[model samples]
Target chain A: MKLKGVQQTNWIGVGIFVLIVLIFPFVVTQSFLLNHATFTGIYVIVSLGLGLLMGYAGQISLGQAAFYGVGAYATAIMTTTYGLSPWIGLIFSIAIAALLAYIMGYTMARLSGYYLAMATLAFGIIVHSVLVEWRSVTLGASGFYGIPSINIFGYTITQGIPYYYFVWAFAIIGIIICLNIVHSRVGRALRSIHDSEIASSAMGVETGKYKTQIFVLSAIFAGVAGWLFAHMSYSISPSSFTLDASIIFLAMVVLGGSSSVWGAVLGTVLITMIQVTVHTLGEQFTFITSEFEHVVYGLILVLVIIFMPRGLFPTISSWLNNKMSQRSSETQEKKAS
Target chain B: MLEVKNVTKTFGGVVANKDVSFSFEEGQIVGLIGPNGAGKSTMFNMISAIFPPSEGEIIFRKQRIDKMPTNAMAPLGISRTFQNLQVFKNMTVVENVMVGRHIRTKTGTLRAALKLPGTKKEEVSAYDKAMEYIQFVGLQDLYDHLAGNLALGKLRLLELARALATEPKLLLLDEIAAGLNHKETKEMSNLIEKIRNNGTTVFVVEHDMDLVMSICDKIIVLDQGEKIAEGTPREIQSNQRVITAYLGAEVEKNAQ
Candidate 1:
């Protein structure tokens, strides 16, 4: 309610993103590149949710990838073993994630700062351990395979251009939904929670309740990404849902600017691109090591922490927005002269 | 009307407020005057429901509010400004006031996410309401300025505007004139009177005797966690106990 939304011009960024999402698959013909791009969309969805939690609500979650794994497993088990529809699996994935988060959200959110981070990290470790130990249902460490490709209205979309278009559609929708929340009363409440929890309570905002709500929502986002990942990859493993993956998602949020939605997507794309790029160049840097991808990512993460600690997306985007406004004013002056 | 009955608040062995009992009728600018660590803020905190009193009952509008949560007070027609400045550092001036209207606002997260018609309508009205308070406190020029960027005096005015936006029946202001210049204090005194005249009961705690004596219809004095005197401005000015409490027996020595 009484929340007056952030009145910044957000539509311009939204417009550019919609255009790019529509034309991106058509222009990019290489299947290898297209595959990585598709994965980027999935990461974008998760990171945007993380950005909302980390940036606005001022809640840190290190178990987001655990939810992602849950979504993937839900899809992998429901469709392959239970013989259910892929759509149902996707929905179940989100539901399961939300239910798990709802149970622990309030207790964990009430513990601020380092306690919150450690709580989430412990949750991630537990989830990952379950995925490894529970062999009967999840296939354990051996992983689940032969997941059916997603199908819509008699069109079986496989591992090429169609899959790219399909997954990016969800990313585009996720971005728009995120933007809507960011500029509305929800965003104001979240930002207020971050600003001062005491003042927010004084203003009638139940800080704990709002924190729990956002935590559940962010978990669902990661779950949705996990669902898409299972169907697209046709297999699943516990390693993808580990604490390291969660840290990378956090890195994505920080590098892109946690408060900015587009920043989340940009950060995901940048990190994913670097991973793909460096994997190829590992042979070239033979003197250094075979695990060059880790070296490159670690370096970038450190640089981001040091030089652009506030986040690159928010800083750069605000600067660009200012420049645009200034040029427009200059143009008006020129016309007057 | 508001009643604080035998309220005693203690943290461990230290009693911050001890057996403090006082009440203010509707539409009165009541001042709670005390020296530092004299339990004025402790009283305000108890009445505002920041924490439950260790021993006492607080009645607001005939309902016992001693057990209510801090957030539950605003909706029960009670609001307060903090002794320490508590403006949302991330929000604009108007946005801070809008947050004060949180209790009255009824939109759900889903409706806000979808940009439904009711949410849109409420948002516009909330903006208008926030702006009205911003102008009331004479911060229309800095309506869009980030609250963290404002001066201490301006922030105090912003807090007043925010509390007023809640439209509380009983408003507790803890040191509303603290850190303000003479002119600013004068304006604040006038605003407090205006707020009282508008039908909201005003409860203020302050060390500024000049401002307190000029505006307060009734005054209560606290010394070392105990209420020493309660009367009108003239009675409080002449009370032997009040003088002895403030001047600490030095006045009684002169009188002897």
Candidate 2:
């Protein structure tokens, strides 16, 4: 009982995606490449959550990295200090993030545009400050170390190859769940609210309730992604999850299509690849400084906003679909006439 | 039936609706007409539960509904089209209508997440109903068009279709004829009558005196948040207070 035309295509795409991800590790043996792919997967999961909140739900959040940091810190603290299992820490992290998100969302949901953005920005900054100032527990600016590797059912994912599979598996699961939510009634309600809050309310969509639910759900996803990252990296610093990281996450949402799930994945992969490549080039080329990379990134962001406001995925997909449909309609009309 | 009793709404110190009382019976087309600042739209807002009246009570289907949120009022079979055409601009015409059907849906979020049988069936039915309303409003040709791209007249039609898609027992229309051409206004008035004929009461706030005079079963005139006259359209047309409040005392004297 799926939506007839698009549903079949989506399932086919998912199948091909599963196949590609499953075979990816075999093709790439380099540790750096594997590590990059794992990081991409983690970002993809978090970005997909952000995309759902911003793109479909019409919310602007600059606090995603805060939730991500919360998850990572919670998992790290739970595993190291409490001597708990990483898996248990993962669950606890998601719960804590969701609880915090629920409280924040209740207050933040009523705000729109610049106000909402500012509130979330403040939240990310606050989280980053806490991580730095709380020295005894968090180890402050030096960052936390000795985070134990994740063990799933007696399988220790300590190295690149095993960890790559683990992160990607979680990413694929995250993508599937996000896809389901996007196509569901909840997604429709969100889109409605995004378009016109008053109209959606008049239609009996409890706007506040739905907003909070999506916010909390997105936080949980970010938390889970953080847990994966913390365990895989075996180290995390407050600097890694700052307001700048939150902006990067938001950039991924905008660079991909905000409303599309695959856009989140594509955006994460492209941005990470670009960052890694540019950093590598900076080491070789004397002129290619960190400042130059920042300039380039800023320029690209401006260009995307001006020309492809819907993001790369939506623009490409719509263009391709438009051409295909045009050909089909022409053929059908020719036959009819 | 919908009843508004001694409803008073004040925005800060300014009174928008003061001691206004009215009731609409089932299967009736009631025209709420007033000049500028007569509080017609404010009274409509109060009836639709957009904001609670500062004083007094609103009863719909024999239930006190003034305290309910606007979102919660849709399930009780009350729906409204906004004065400025509040169609979901990002959505297609059909999707805008489908949102109206959301209240009737029995699917829980978890069930929707899992794509359960209940949600699947409900989704299909909701789409079908949306299509029906789109056709009812004569917008079937533009069913898949994004509401934002539609012309002003079409957007109004889309808003009406969306409100109708809720399967409402009573529909409130605020300035539905405000921007329409003469022909479009006539068509709108006829369509509203047809909707009323289909066992739904219609309460419309209109500035078009011609449409109100021709189509309304009963007319309620307000002046500065006070009910000046309530009767058949002919009675309202001849009412001295309504003429004085609407057309000025000089115009009323000339008419007499």
Candidate 3:
């Protein structure tokens, strides 16, 4: 539906964002840089799902990587063990991830705020342990391999330039879906539930139903991201799907902006860049380790929470809005005089 | 028509509502009034299915709904505003009201994501309906404003409009005019009357004596979780029991 005064939406900011997504690969030529870019796209997809729970439904989840792992492993086991297409594996991924989410989200039907955060944290750890201990299926902690490259429309994306575009294409679709939801009745109900569960229930919004639905939807997004990452990396270990990855996903959503859809993408890009930078520095310095990456992420998360609590996109967007409006008003005055 | 038959609610050792039995005929502006700790809100909550009664049953349109969940209350033609405004602060005024139209609309997550044919049409109609109520509440100019930014009177009006958008058969106003000044209270009274005239049964829980007396066709009074008196406004005005309940008279009032 069209909001009456929605014509005043910041189109310039939207255009700039579009430009960034489009030119990112062309701007960054190195394969190492391109790999980070690909990861950014995947993280954006997963974090956008988190945004649905965190931003819209007002539920925080730290178990996204479990869903991500479920999706990736589904892709790995189905194609490698059962001899199935990754696309078919993709369908199984969604189904399994949805099942996992429903089973886990059942506990969250009445949970909220920090209690929910803890539940999801515990759930993430449980899924991580399963991924590790399930030696029969997951191939144990040795990490599964021989995962085939992703084939989109009869073509393989080797993560060169085509894979970058491929990952981003899905990211763009994820963005569109997130945007469409926030403008729809479903989005409104989730937001209303977030504002006040009592009032939403009073208004005949099945708050629990919406909460569970968003939880499942968020899992599906993480599953899909996990699908992409599994095929692209040709490998996925328990370490990749641990609580650290889940926390990183949460950090991206927070650092981007809580409720802003673009904030998901922005936050993912910023965090991914940070990861790449730290990894690059670690490679150069012999003593420095990947452990150093966690410290950087921790510092950034704390700083963002303290300073830009609402995240960068909303704050920066508002600043841009003020600047644009002030300039236009000044021009209008000049023309009148 | 709605009936509360011998409903009793106990919170731990405290009885919030005891054997509260009454019925409202269709199309009447009914008021539930009482002093502090009178269990007026507790009664409203039970009726709205915020919680089930400890004993007794509530029949809405002749269906037993004592166990229905709170969200089910709206679709069953029972919608209510809160004692405190619960308008979504992050949403625009129109969006806040649109949340009420949720039960009426049928756009699921997949359909909403795809923007299917029925979804957009339903959305447009919902938008038009939300606007009509926004205008009805005399808030047409602030339709796009954030609901939290509106003045107190307008916020109350927004809640009413949101409740109305549910297309309810019975509308419950919980202290709808609680914090308004005299002029705003009068406007709220008129709005309640207009809603009643528009064919939705209006049941108001209020402490504003003048506002309640001026608009309500029937007044039901509660005190200490029991039904104290039930009568027309004129009868309630002169009722000795009500007077004693309000003024703390030493002697018991004669019941006629």
Clashes of each: 0, 0, 0
Which clashing pairs does model 3 show?
Answer: none
B123, model 3: CA deviation in Å?
Answer: 1.5
How high is the TM-score of chain A in each model? 0.92, 0.95, 0.92
Error of 3 at B41 (Å): 0.9
In model 1, state the lDDT of residue A301.
79
Model 3 whole-model lDDT (C-alpha atoms): 0.87
Error of 3 at A221 (Å): 1.1
Off by over 4 Å in 3: A5-19, A283-288, A322-337, B250-256
Give candidate 2 regions above 4 Å deviation. Answer: A1-9, A329-337, B12-14, B181-187
Interface C-alpha RMSD per candidate, 1 decimal: 2.5, 2.3, 1.4
Candidate 2, position A315, lDDT: 95
Ranking of candidates on DockQ, top first: 3, 2, 1
lDDT of 3 at A127: 83
Candidate 2 at A309: error in angstroms?
2.2
lDDT of all the models against the reference?
A: 0.86, 0.86, 0.87
True contacts kept of each: 0.43, 0.56, 0.70
Q: TM-score for model 3?
A: 0.95
Clashing pairs in 1: none
- Candidate closest to the true structure, highest lDDT: 3
